[model samples]
Structures are given as structure tokens and as C-alpha cells.
Target chain A: MEKGLIAIAAALAVMTGMVTGIGEASVARQAVESIGKNPDAADKIRSMAILGAAISETCAIYGMLVAFLIIFVLGA
Target chain B: MRAVFELQGTVFYIIAVCLAILVFLIILNMKLKKFDPLDEPKGLVLMAMMGVNFIENMLKKDTNKEMTEKLGPYLAFLFIYIFIANISGLFGLTPPTSNYSVTLTLAAITCIMIEYYSIKYNGVKSYVKKLFEPLAPFVVINIISKVGTLLSLSLRLFGNIIAGSILMSVVYQLLARVSALIPVIGKFNFVGVIVCSVLHMYFDLFAGAMQTYLFGTLTVAFISNELPEEAKGK
Candidate 1:
């Protein structure tokens, strides 16, 4: 059971990283495209991108917490 | 396990450091030719917003004047700083505002500042009298309402950020398992990323900014209400 849980935790970490990376890429793309079309809106787009990326990372944090709980609390 | 700083002490330090950096940056930027020359840079613009908020209360204005003018910038700054702090969870840094002590101290400072200015602008007698007006024997209720501001502000900020962080972690873990079972679609984890990013932006950044603005505006309203009719120039 412990082995299984550890495997699960590892998987979760990877997923979190993947999700965060994808989210960041999309936001970056959108930001760049928007800036290219309207240089004047670059500041707004940058702020939005930052906000979008920060929000996107929430899932990763959730995954980490669960992995910790499983390891420490469940002793898995 | 050893306490480096008592929780409250740590909170005080965080607030002090944040405020000190804000003040120092403001003063330094003011002297820099580039900052003052044409249009202000984005970083300095954010800082200036904060500076305006800090000085908002100090500016004397009639009661009829819209309170936003005095409090808007400060509210904007509070939101920006608090939102940034809360979102620091993404980078694995413990959000200072996540701790109750930090929020409580911030609320307390705002409360004290509002009350102090109220009394200063209006003599003690009038200040006390204003509390009893439009209704009598409800002075205690009014005082409690004032104190309640701290509780509401602290809890709102703390609850939102904590919930967002906790939820994000949980979702990531669950999704990871699902993705593993379906290997073909696993290569594109774009959906998870987009969902998480949007949620963080809304809950942490957007909401956080709005909350900060509300808190600052509320403080201005609370203090302005205490000013005497003459002081209001009405």
C-alpha cells in the first residue's frame, strides 16, 4: 500500500508540473500575441499574464499538499 | 520547532518590512530623473498608487467630497501587495497574510489610524457624541460594529487565499491520477494548466485586489464619518 501511494504521489507531482507548464505557455502566447497587435496594451497584457500564471499554479500546490498528507499522515 | 519570532512578532515584522520597502522605494523613485521624466514606469505607477493611498487620510477634505479620491490609491496598493503575497504560494513561499496575526495587525493598524484621525479632526466630545447620534443607548453596538471591521477584513483575506491554495493542491493530485490512466491524451496537459491559471487569477489576483480596495475604502469611510460638520465644510 505504501509503495502504491508513493507511486501515486510521484505521479501527482509530475502532473502538477505539466499542468503548470502548459498554463504558463498558453498565457505567454496570448500575452505575446496581444502585445504584437497593440503595443499600447502590453502592460495590461503582462499584468493579466502574471495573474493567469499565478492562478494556474494553484493546482500544483494542491497536488503537493495531498502528496504530503499521504506520506506523513497516512504514512503511505 | 523552535519559535524564531512569536507569530504576532513575525507578522509585525512582515508588515513593517513591506511598508518600509514601499516607503523607501517611493522616496527613491521620486528622486530618480527617469521616474519623474515622462510617463512613470509600471513598477513606479504601482508604488505611486500606494503612496497616494498612504497620504489619502492626511489630506483634509469636506465630507461631501467622494471618499474614493482619498482612499482609492491606497485601496489599490493594498490589493496589489496582498494579492502578490497570497499568490506567493505558487512559488512555495508561505504567504504572510495567510497567517491570522498578519491580517489582524493590518486591520488593527487601520482601525487605530481611523480612530486617531477621527478624534483629532473632531474633539473627543464630538467624537463620542457622533457615536450616539440618530439612536441612543446603542453606543455599544456602534463600537462593536467598528471593531467588527477587523474581523471581517482579516477573515475574508485569510479564508480566500488559504482555500485557493488548498484547492489547487487537491485538484492537481486528483487530475494526475486520471491522466496516468489515459496515456494517449496525457501528452497534452493543457486543460489542467488553463483551468488552474484562470482560477488563480480570479481568486488570488483579481479577488485579492478587490478586497484590498474595499478594505482601504472602508477605512476612509469609517474615519470620515467621525468628522464634525464644520470639519466637513458642510
Candidate 2:
């Protein structure tokens, strides 16, 4: 019963990724739109987009990290 | 080994591995000392030139000449050490960066440098003013964000390596299950060898290099950001 509860909790904790997915899509869309407008600045825009995306994904990573910690470390 | 030397295994392994790589790099660099880089270098000479050029170009682009000269060697050492540590997982040893002790030390040094240099370049008054910003309430957020940088930098590297190692173990377990359908080969992990090779390529080599690039680039970018705009040649 405790194992099941922990498992369910871990699953629910990762629901934060839903927001992350939407955020990632919007970031990509804007990056692509900007690149299209300024062809010459594509390299700079690409690097900026990657750095921005990586930052935006932090919350999702944190969520997964917490879930894993809860399931393995706390549940134990 | 432990009985003879009374040594802790992981600590000893980390030291020996790092020293071995350092020695190898030194020997390679020594061998290339006589080669002129402009004469269409090849082989080991070309590799050394590529590494030096990468660091020089990266530092030149990011910082002023004085700052570049001051910090270039430090950043280059950081880049090479981390690149090796990340890929060291391929040797079936614990990558030092995956250890929180190692990562925390690196991040703490970076954080201290960021704070120190920012204050030094901008002066205490301006640094405090920058923190307070257009509103007083933002100071709390500013402080939190500073801590955030340290946590994110360290955690990102640690979490990535640990997660990859965990997933690779899972892959091994799955491989064992699949191979169990066959004969005694299951005990020997026949399927694991094939699948793990591809997994290791993705996880260790490709991801390792990419993460090293991200870490190095972010270090330069963050340091540059901390400098005054005029100082940064903006």
C-alpha cells in the first residue's frame, strides 16, 4: 500500500512537465520566427534559443528530480 | 590494494585516473612543441592546435584582452578537466563531476568568482545599487537568483550524469530479461553488450561533449554578464 502511494505520488509530481512542454513549444516557435526574419543572425539566434530553452527546462528537470528522490530516497 | 595501502577505493581511483589523463595531455603537448601551427598541421599537432584555438577564440570573443589573458588558462583547464571527467564514465568509473562534493566545489568557486569579480569591477556601491535595482523589493529576488545560479549549475551536471547512469542500469536489467529467453547467454549478457554500446555512445560520448560545451560556454557567458557593459567592450 505504501509502495503504491509513493508510485502514485511520483506520477502526479511529474505533471509539471505539461507546462514545460507548452513553454518549450512557444520558445521554439519564437526562435524559429526570429530566425526566419533575420537569416544572417541565425547562428546567434540558434545559440540564444538553445540557452533559453535549457533554462526553461529547469523546472521540468527539478520536477523529475524530486519525483525520483521521493520514490527512491523518501519512500525507502 | 586497500589492505596494502589502507586507501579508500573511489578517492584513489579518481586521483589516479585524473593524473593519468593529465600526464597523457602533457606528453602530447610536449611532442607537438616543435610544430608550427600555420604550416597545415595534421595528426596530434592539429588536435592540439584545435584545442588551443577553441579556447583562444572563445575567450577572445567573451572577455576583454586583459581579462582574457588573466582567466584564459583557468577556463581552458576547466574545459579540459570537465570534458575528461564527463567522458570518464565510459571507463566504468565514477565521473568526479557526478559526485556532489566535486561539483559543489566547482560551483562554489564559480559563485565566489562571480561575486568577487562583479564587485571588483563595478565597485560595492554600484553592485549594491544594481542589486536593489529600480525597486527595493527586487533585492530579495536578486539574492534568490544568485543562489539559483549556483544550484542550477551544479545540479544540472550532477543530475545528468546520475540519471544517465541510472537509465543505463535499467537498460542492463531489461537486457537481462530479454536475453533470459535464450540459453546460458542470458547469464553472460549477450544482448546487453550490443545495446549498451549504442547507449554508451549516446550517453557518454555525444552527451558528454555537448554538456562540456554548454558548461564552458555558460561559464564564459555568465562571467561576461557580470562585468560592466563598457568593461565588456559592449
Candidate 3:
């Protein structure tokens, strides 16, 4: 029962990726829209978008770390 | 039972670092004859010059001539070392950047550089005063945020690389199992060979380059923000 609960907790923890995916999707969408408006600035906009998306990815990573800890440390 | 002293990827990381240093040493040790403006640089000279020029141009955006002169080589080295380390997985080696300790130390160095430049440019008095900001109580929060940058920087690189590795391994395992269903060819992972190359292109090459560029850019941004606009030559 405890192991099952731990599995559930890990699953919950990994749900943070969903949040990150949504955030990154919006970031890419805006970047593409801006590039369409001003193609000359696409390079700068693309870099900025990638940076922002990468930074936002830290949240999901933290969640993943927690999930791994729960499964490996606790489940063990 | 899991070993308490996990030494995962340390050896591979060291190998990657040595490889990066050796490459740089070779490039640095090369003898070059002075050439006319019309003469084109060839081979290693072209690569070395282009790398230096690229790093300098990137630094020029955020720093003054003196700052760029000081930081250009260091940032170039950091970028190359990270790019090499992150992509070492392609050569059947564990990528050192995926290791938390390795990424943490790298981020700590960047954090130290940020603080060093902040103190150097803005003076010790202003540095301490900036921590207090609008109120004395804010110092705790300020310190936390400063430390947060260190953790975030390290964790970002570590997480990205590790995630890519984890996903690739899972994919490979799945591919092997799927390929095993075949009758005769089940002996070999034919599916993995075909699919993994595409996956490696994104997971290793693209991600490695992007992370290296982001790390360099963020390091420059953080450090340069501490300097005055005049000092930054912008």
C-alpha cells in the first residue's frame, strides 16, 4: 500500500511537466508570431524565446527531481 | 543496496575536461605567420580565429573593451568545455554535465564571478548597501535570491542533460524490447539504430549547443548587469 502511494506521489510530481509544456508552447507561439511580424529580428527573438523556455523548464525539472527522490529513496 | 559514495560520471567528466584542454592547447600552441588582409586563414587558424571572434562579439554586447578583453577567453573556454561535455554521450561516454556535482561546481564558479565583478565594479560599500535595498530586513531575501541564482543555474543544466539521457535510455530500452518481437532479426536492435540517430540529433547535439549558448549568455548577462553602463561601454 505504501509503495502504491509512493507511485501516486511520483505521478503527481511529474504533472509539473504539463504546466511547463503549456508555458513553453505559449512562448514558442509568441516567438513565431513576432518573427512573422518582424522577420529581421527573428534571430534575437528566437534566442530570447529559447532562453525563456529553458529557464521555465527548471520548474518541471525540480518536480522531476522530487519524483525521482520519492521513487528511489522512499520506495527503496 | 545502493552505494553511499556514488561516483557516477566523474571519470568521464574528467576525460571530457582533459579533451577540451588538449584541444585548446593545440590551437594555442600553433604557429601562425602574419598574413596580408587579402590572405584567408585556413584550417585550425580559421576555426580558432572564428571561435575567438564569435566569443568577442557575444561579449561586446554586454561588456566594455576591457571587460571583453578579460572575459572573452574564459567565456570561450566555458562554452567549449560545456559543449564538449554535454555532447560526450554521442561517443558512448556519460556526459559530465548530467552530473549534479559537475554542473553545480560550474554554476558556483559563475556565481563567484558574478559576485567578484559586482564588488569590483560597484565597490564594496555599494555591494553591501544594494543588499539592504529599501529596508534592512530585505537583506535575508536578497541573500536568498543570490543563492537561488546559483542553484537555478546549476539545476537547469543538470536537469536538462539528465532528462535527455533518461529519455534516451528509456527509448532505447523500449526499442530493444520492440525489436525483440521480430523472428530472426530479434537478435539485433535494428529499430534502435534507425530511430536513435534522430533522437540523438535533438537530445545531444541541439540541446547541448542550446544549453552551452544559454549558459554563456546568462553568465555574461548576470555579471554585466553588476557593472555600470559606462563601464559596460553601452
- Candidate achieving the largest DockQ: 3
lDDT of 1 by residue, A40-63 (tens): 987556655665654465556556
The order by descending TM-score is: 2, 3, 1
Error of 1 at B190 (Å): 7.2
Off by over 4 Å in 1: A1-76, B1-31, B35-80, B131-136, B182-191
- Cα lDDT tens digits, model 3, B1-234, are 988886665775677667777976675655344434477878767777898988888788778888898888789878888998888889877888988888999999999999999999899999999999989999999999898789878887888899899999999999999999999988699999899999999999999998898899889878877897778764
CA lDDT of each prediction against the hidden true structure: 0.64, 0.80, 0.86
Cα lDDT tens digits for candidate 2, A27-51: 9999999999999998778778777
Identify the CAPRI category of the predicted complex in candidate 2: acceptable
DockQ of the two-chain complex in candidate 1: 0.03
Candidate 2: how close is chain B to the reference, as a TM-score? 0.89
Error of 2 at B149 (Å): 0.4
lDDT (Cα, tens digit) per residue for candidate 1, span B20-57? 55776677666554554466556656666566645453
Predicted candidate 2 versus true structure: per-residue lDDT over B148-174, tens digit per residue: 888777777777777777798899899
For model 3, the DockQ equals: 0.48
